[model samples]
Target: MTLALFDLDNTLLAGDSDHSWGEFLIHKGIVDAKAYGKANDAFFEDYKNGTLDIVAYQEFALTALIPLDSAQRKQLHNEFMAQVITPMMQPKAVKLIEKHRQQGDTLVIITATNSFVTGPIATALGIDTLLATEPEIIDSMFTGKIVGIPCFQEGKIVKLNEWLSTTGHSLDGAWFYSDSANDLPLLERVANPVAVDPDERLLKHATEQQWPVISLRD
Candidate 1:
């Protein structure tokens, strides 16, 4: 079966759902009070603009939420399942996911967002698999650190390659759908790349590459 990799956040949810989830945690006092809100806005900003440095995310996540021990960060990320997501998912995106499922494509939600916040979202969508950033954890608690690589840009490729090796699936005529230039690496790697309401940079690049662009938003 072919694969269809979908990005979370703006690709499906219409906004930075993970950051919004972080915002919810700030309001809930789930994360460190001092590191809440825009404490790492620079990282989020770079992410949105498709220029994020994964190393910065790792550093910032650790230094920003020092108050919360690993347990606390895990708790916040776990609670984020109910408090931060669900409501943000768009009906259209859900429908698209269902459509892909009905076609028998192996669907995976490949994102740079943390696995904790995105795990439930991927489950809600009935995704076959998920590949995202892994937050640092010790004794089942968040360390406020990134012990592994942040899944973004070229990182998706690396993660996908490893996953394919496990699933015995390769990117042979597979598809990738996303709306951000940050996802350009993913789009380029896939055999059939479709940009849905892509940002300006992605739009231009897709045009140059002759990759098909689909617009769900007017």
Candidate 2:
């Protein structure tokens, strides 16, 4: 079966989950509103500009989980789902996923966001496989550290290769959908690269390369 890969943030969801999670923390008074929000916005900008320091961003994002136990974190995330993420779920995006599902594609959500923030979002979308940056855990608690390579840019290719090796899956006829220029590396690797409501840089690249550009928002 052909592999169907999706980028989780702007391509699938209407908003960025990692940034929203940071906002959620600020809203719940778990983090300093000014400092955390500023950093969050700055990091998002860095991501957009393709200048993001993945390890640094991961450290900042995952650090919030270090203080909470798994149960508490789950509860907060459930609330986040209800309050923030639910509205971001787009009907067109769901339809696209369902269309692929009906075709028997191996659906996967590959994202730079940590698994703790994205795991439930993937489940809510009815996707079974998710490849996201992992937060190190010990004794059922987050250690606020990454276990392996941060799944960003070229790291995505590395992670995908590692997964492919064990799962017997190949990129033959693989399709990748994404919105950011940062994903150009993997987008270039896929057999079918679709830009969903692409950013300026990605739009320019997609146009020049004649890649199919579609939108989930409209």
Candidate 3:
């Protein structure tokens, strides 16, 4: 079966879940509004410029969940989904995913955001498979540390290759849709690379490479 890989934030969704989660925490008074918002914006800027240090960013992002137990985390995420993520979902993106499903392609959401955040979002999108950065957990509590290679930049290719090996899936006829230049590494490896409402850098690269550029936003 052909593989259809999707970037969760910005490509499939209208906003960045990681950044929105941080904002959500601030709105809920869970984190210091000024400091967390400043840091979150900085991290997002780094991400856009393709200069993000995934390990450091993960440390910062996952640290917020350390104090919450599994149940509390789930509740908090549900609120986030209802208030933040729901608005980010786009009809065009859903149609794109449904199109792939109609073609019998194996669908997967590959994102740098932790599984704790992206898992439900993927399920809500009707996708069964997701590959995301893993937040370490012990005894049902977050450790605030990542357990494996982060699914970012070249790390995305490494993580996807590992998943492909275990699932007996190959990149043959693979289609990857993404919005950021950060995804160029995995984008280059796919059989079909589509840039979805891409940033400035990715737009230029996709133009030069003759990759299809499409937008999910209305």
Candidate 4:
């Protein structure tokens, strides 16, 4: 089967889910506005400039889930799915996914965002397969630590290869769509790489590589 991998944040959705989730929590008073908000903005800026430290940012993002119980976190995620993520699903993205669905490819969303936040968003987008950063848990309580690879930068290629090995698939003719230069490793690995509203770094890379660049926004 052909592989079709997508980057979730700014590639499919109109906004960055990881950053937006932090904003949502701050707005709901789940996180302190002044400190959390400031740090979140700084991390996002770092990400845009391709200078983000994934390990540090992951700590900042996932730790927000530590205090809440599973039920409370689930409820908040449900609210996030409806209020924050749903509207960000661009119609163009849906149609593009549908096109690949009709082609019967093995569709997967390989995102750097932690599973706690991105899982529902993947489901909402009609994708059942997701390879995301896993949050550690102990006795059903989130530990606010990453369990395995962060799925950032080159880590995405490693995670995807592991997933492909278990699923009996190959990236021989796979397609990967992403927005940031951070994904350049996997983007280069795939046979068909599409840059979706890419950042400056990725746009320049795509131009040099002559990869197809498309926009999934109005």
**How does each model score on TM-score?**
0.85, 0.99, 0.99, 0.98
Roughly what TM-score does model 1 have, to 2 decimal places?
0.85
Sort the predicted structures by lDDT, highest score first.
2, 3, 4, 1
Clashing pairs in 1: 70-141, 70-142, 70-143, 71-141, 74-142
Tens digits of per-residue lDDT for model 1, 137-163 = 676555667756678888889889989
True-structure lDDT of candidate 4: 0.93
Clashes of 4: 0
**Whole-model lDDT, candidate 2?**
0.95
With a 3 Å backbone cut-off (N, CA, C), the pairs that clash in candidate 4 are: none
Candidate 4 regions exceeding 4 Å error are none
Please identify model 1 stretches exceeding 4 Å from their true place.
30-35, 62-84, 216-218
Clashing pairs in 2: none
lDDT string, candidate 2, 42-86, tens digits = 999999999999999999998888889978998999999999999
Off by over 4 Å in 2: none
Q: Rate the local accuracy (lDDT) of all candidates.
A: 0.76, 0.95, 0.95, 0.93
List model 3 lDDT by residue over 1-218, tens digit each.
99999999999999999999999999999999999999999999999988998889899988888889988999999999999999999999999999999999999999999999999999999999999999999989888899989999999999999999999999999999999999999999999999999999999999999999999998
Alpha-carbon lDDT of model 3: 0.95
lDDT of 4 by residue, 1-218 (tens): 89999999999999999999999999899889999999999999998887889888988998888888989999999999889998898999999999999999989999999898998888888999999998898988887788888898899999998998898999989999999999999998999999999999999999999999999998
